[model samples]
Target chain A: MTINSKIQNINCCDHIARRVGDIAPSGIRKFFDLLASMDGVISLGIGEPDYPTPYHIREAAISSIENGYTMYTPNSGIPELRQELSKHLKNTYNLDYADSQILITVGVSEAMDLAARALVNPGDEVLIPDPCYVSYSPCVVLAGGVPVMIPTCEEERFEISAEKIEPLITEKTKALLIGYPANPTGTIMPREKLEEIVKLANQHGLIIISDEIYSRLVYDCEHTCIATLPGAYENTVFLGGFSKAYAMTGWRIGYAVGPASIIAAMTKIHQYTIMSVPTMSQVAAVEALRNGETSAAEMVADYNRRRLVMVKGLCDIGLSCFKPQGAFYAFPSIKNTGMTSEDFAHNLLMEEKVAVVPGNAFGRCGEGYVRCCYATSLKELYEALERMERFLKKRGASQAATFQV
Target chain B: MLNKILRLLEDDGRLTPEQIATMLGTETSQVKELITQAEKDGLILKYKAVVNWDKIAEEQVWAIIEVRVTPQMKAGFDAIAERIYKFPEARTVMLVSGTYDLAIIVTARNMHEVASFVTHRLAPIEGVQGTTTHFLLKRYKEDGVVLDDKNKGMRQKVVL
Candidate 1:
C-alpha cells in the first residue's frame, strides 16, 4: 500500500482511548493562540506573575548546579525541599505535616494531576467549584472520573458554600477539588465558609483536594489552609507551589501534603511517570522556602496595589467588578456591555489591542464576566485600562444609537 | 506611606504622582499632597537623571583629587570644603576620613583641563598643601546603573 493509504488504514481515533477523546480542548487556548500572533497586545489573560524568580533563589539553583547536584532526586522529592515545605506549611498556616507525607511535583499543575490519578477510580465523580482553575475538571476527567461543577455566583463573591455542595454529593462522589485563593475569580474561600465544606466532606466521606497555589497572594485577608481545619487533616490533599508566591513559574516546583497513604499512592504514580522533579529546581525551592519569604511578601504587596488600580479602573469604566481579595486577577462583569464574554474579549482585542480572558474560559457560570490579571507592570495595566475605557465608550455609543433606531 | 512614595520616586524619577497613588493604593490627591509637602520640606532635593556620558562620542574627563589642607581654627574642613565645592568643576567634595583630608571629584572637558584645574585652580587655594590626582579610566557603574550593554535582557512572554 502507498504511504497515504497505509496511514489512512491505521485509524488514529480508533487507536486513541475514548477518555482522551472525550476531554474537550481548553477554552483558554484560542485566546492564547490569538495573543501569540498579535504584536503590541496588552494581555491581562495570563495567570502567572510577571516577576522573575528572586535573586537568592536563582543563586541557590546556580550554586547547586556548580556543586554537581545534577543527578535525579528521590521519586518523592529531595528531603531538604520536603522538609522546608513542611516547616513552611507549619509556619505559614499552622498545619503540620511530616516530610514523608509531602511529595514535590512539577508545580501545582502536576500535583493536581497526581491527586486526580491517585484518588479517582473509573466512573467516580469529583465535585469542583464552577469557574475554578481550568485544569481541575480536565484532570478529573483524564483520571477516568466524572467532574461535577458546583455553580458559584458573583453575589457571594464566587465562593462555593457548603449549602451548594452538600446536596450535590451522591454515593459516587469520591472527592471535592478546590483552589483558593481561586484563579479566574481571584476570590478566597473564607475560613468560616470552609468550615462548612469541611463538615460536609466529613459527613459524606469525601476527599478534598485543596489547590492553594495563590495562598500567599491574598490582599488584606488571611488564607486559611483547608487542611488546617479541625477534621480536614485526614481527608484533605493540600497542593501548593512557588510559582505564584515566589514568582518562580519557570522553576516548576510544587509540593503536595496529605495523609501518608494518599501521599504514598501519589508517589507510586509519580515514580512510574515523572520519576522525580529536577534536582536543581528542588534546591531552588528549598532556597525559596528558606530565604524568599520577604520577596514573596513584597510581590504580594505589589499585586495588592495593582489589584486596587485594576478593580477601580474596571468599575470606573462601567464594568462592574467584584473586588478580588486574592490572586492577581480581577473578574469584572461585562453584562452591561450587551455582549457575551467571548465577544467582549475578542472585540476588545480587535478594536483596542487589549487581551483579556473571557470568564467562560473557566466554566459555564463565568459567561458574562472577563478575567483581567493585574500581575503585569503598573504601566501596562494603566495602558490596558485606558484602552478598555475607550473601547467601552465606543461600545456604549454604538449601543445607544442602536437603541434609538 | 510618604516614605514609600519617596523611595519609589527615588528609584524611578519618571513615575508620576498618579502612578504612585495607584501603585500605593492611595488617592491621587493624597500622593500629590505628600509629594508637595516633601518638596517644600526639602526631603526630596531634586530629581535628576543618572547619565552615563561615557557612551557618547564626546570625550569627558573625571579626576579624583586628594587634598591635604590645614584645618581652620573654628570651621575645620567645612570651610575648605565649601570653598572647593563652590566651583562647578568639582562634581563632589567630601571630607574623607582616610589618609587624605579632603576628596574632590572634578569633571572637565579633557585630561589637560582636569590637570590644569588641579594645578592652577585647586592647588592654588590658600589652605591646600599637597595634591594627588587620579584620572578615572572607565566607569563600570554610576549611581547604581551599570554602564555596559544597554539591553535589559528582554523577558520571554509566558502563558499559562
Candidate 2:
C-alpha cells in the first residue's frame, strides 16, 4: 500500500501539546534571519566567543576519537569528568560535592531544562528574575509550571533582592532560578544579596537553580558560588559549563551539582531524555578541567580588555551603557532615542549594518535597552563602534538630541 | 602596568596611548607617563611594523647565517657579536648557544648583495672564524602572525 504523504485535512500545529504551544519562539531568531540576508554587517549580537576552542582541548577530543572512545558511558556522565568537575567545585568554592552529585548534561542549557522538568509539578511557580537568560522562564513553562518574573532594573544593578522576591512568593512557588554574570545585564550578584536570597529560599523551603555558567568571567571580582553559602547547598542546583569560560560552546558540555535527591531526579530525567553527553565532548571537558585554568584565565583577560573598550565605546556613542561586571554583553539604555528596543535594533541593523539584540527579547524589564555582545575581535568591535556612532549621529541629527561627534 | 602597555603596543604598534588606556581601563596620562619612562629606560627600543615584503611587489632577499666566532680574551663572544651586529645589513644578530656561536639574519636586495656582505664585511671581522649561510625561501608566518592568510569565517553574523 502506498503511503499517503499528504494529510492536508489536518493542521499539525493545532495538535501541538499545550505546554509546547505555551512557549514562545525566541524573538531574536527573526532578527538574525533579517541579518542573514544582509552583507557587511558588523554584529555585536553573538553570545558565543569568537575564539575557537583551545588547541589542547580540541587535541584531547581528537585523541579520544582516535582511541575509539565513541560508546556511551553511564547516564550521568563519564566518571572521570564527574570526578574532575567535583574536585573543581571543591577547589574553587570549597563546596563539597562527591562525583555522584554531579550530572553532566549537553550544556548548561540542557541542565536548565532538566532541572525545571525534574522539579516542577503542575502549576508550580518558579520565581525567575526578569532580564534573565531567555531560556529560564520558557523551560519552566514547558515543565508545566508558571514563571513569576520579578522585574529588575539598572537602579538595582539589575539584582533580584529577596525583598522583591518575598512579595511574589506563594505556596505554589517551588523554586527560584537565578543566573549571575547574567545575560544582557552582566550583573554578578553580590555575596550579601546572595545570602539574603539563600535565607529566603530556606525559609520558604524553595529550591534554587543557580546558573553560574559565567562564573569564571567576572572582571576584577571574586565570584560567590551560592552553594557555599550557609543553608544554600541543600537547596541550590548549581549549573556550570565550559561553554563561556573555556571558549567551548561547540563542545556542548556542562554539569549540574546539587543535593542527592535533586541530582538523582535530574539524572532520572536526563537518562530517559539524553542517555549521556557525547563521549568525545566529555573527554574534552576532562581536559578542560585538568589543564584549562590557564587558558581560561587568558581568555578572560582578553575579554576584559574588550569589555573596557566596549563599555567606553558605547558610552562614547551616547548609548549610556552600564559597566557590565561580567559576561560578554553590554546592555545599554536606548530609551533616549524615542524608539522601542525592537525598533532601535532593527533600524540600526537596517540603516548602519550593525546588529544588536533588542533587550526586551530577554524579558519585559529588558525594554528600552539592547544587548551588544563584545566577544568579537577588538578590530571588529572598533569598527562596529564607529558604525554605531555614525548611526546614532545620523538619527540624532534628525531628532532633538545632538551627539558629541 | 608597563608590561601590559608593552604587550598592547607589541601586538599593534599603531595603538595610541589613549586607545591603550581605554582598553586597559587606565588613565591616558598614566599610559603616556609609563610609555615615556619605558622609552627613557631603553626598555622599549623601537616601534616597527612586521611587513610581508613579498606582498609589496618589491625585491627582497634574506639569509640566515650561522657564524662560528672566536671569543675574545676578556669580552668573550659579546664583543664579536656586537661588531657583527653593528653592520647595517645584519637585520637580526644574536649570540646563540648551539653549534654556531653567533646567529644572524641578513636581508638585502638580492642574493648578490647578501653574498658580498658576508664575504666582504662579515667574514673579514677579527673574531669571525667560519660562516655558513642559508638563503631564506619563503615566509609562512612573521612576528607571530600568519602571512597571506584568508579570512576563515567560522562564526555566524548573529547567534543566540
Best by DockQ: 2
lDDT (10s digit) by residue, model 2, range A88-126: 888898888987789999999999999999999999999
- Angstrom error of the Cα, residue A130, model 1: value is 1.3
Model 2 misplaced regions, further than 4 Å: A5-10, A397-405, B148-151
Q: Write the per-residue lDDT of candidate 1 for residues A1-405, one digit (tens) a residue.
A: 699899888978788888888787776677677767888888887788887788899999999999999999999998888888888888878888986799999999999999999999999999999898888999999999999999999888899989999889999999999999988998888899999899999999999999999989898778888998989999999999999999999889898999999999999999999999999999999998899989998888888878977887777778887788898998888888889998998899989988888889889999999999888888799899889889988867222211100
Across B1-160, the per-residue lDDT of candidate 1 in tens digits comes to: 9889988888778888887886677789999999999999999999999987877889898899999999999999888889899999998998889888999999899999998898888888889899999999989988766788464334433254
Extract clashing residue pairs from model 2: none
Look at candidate 2 and tell me the lDDT of residue A220.
Answer: 84
Interface RMSD of 2: 1.1
Candidate 2 DockQ category? medium
True contacts kept of 1: 0.40
